[model samples]
Target: MTRRPNPFNQQAMEEVLRDLGCPESLIPSTISNYRLFVPLLFTELGEERVYQLVSRTRDELTLGEQEEAWRSSIKYIVAWAETVMEQYKHKRSNAPKSDSPDDKQPRLL
Candidate 1:
């Protein structure tokens, strides 16, 4: 089954990136590549932890430290996304198959 995209999270992440100074031209690809996984990350780690991770990208710390923090956070999120996707695929593959013909069609009285 194909998964539907979530427009609300997409728009919210775009706004978050804009607030963090992401360029206009990069928003679409960035949303697909990075920000789309944010909802899952928030679900797995909670809003406060995810917010703290994102907040590091905007901190006024030394440049290298900030970059390191941002990269590490992104790495964590990407890894988690991969793991979750894999688990979803595995569970879907293991789901029980319908055994009755009626399971595939609605009955009419």
Candidate 2:
């Protein structure tokens, strides 16, 4: 793997979100809380799941650090987002399956 940067670059994160088709409304907060939940999301699910989970971006530190307030705020959002992602995964994985047996289904020519 390439050597990674600090994992918290402003412009790079914005560009990445743009590539992912994230909407403008979510661009700020989601990115701020991004690092908090990214690794956990990846490990529990996968890259695609990670993308789906982090649909927004935010800079929790919009004001000064002022203490640990911003960091904790980010953590809270990430935790909530993680629950949503997990629920979505469960729904997807348990979705209705095809009726035909695997090998018995006819393929298109």
Give me the displacement of residue 62 in model 2, in angstroms: 6.6
Q: What is the C-alpha RMSD of each candidate to the true structure, in Å?
A: 13.9, 13.3
**What are the per-residue Cα lDDT tens digits for candidate 1 across 2-97?**
454565677777888899998897777776656446546545765355546666755553234454666577666566776776776689699888
lDDT by candidate, in order shown: 0.65, 0.60
Total backbone collisions for each predicted model: 0, 11
Q: Candidate 2, residue 39: CA error in Å?
A: 12
Among these predictions, the greatest TM-score belongs to 1
Worst 10 residues of 2 by lDDT: 56-65
TM-score of each: 0.35, 0.34
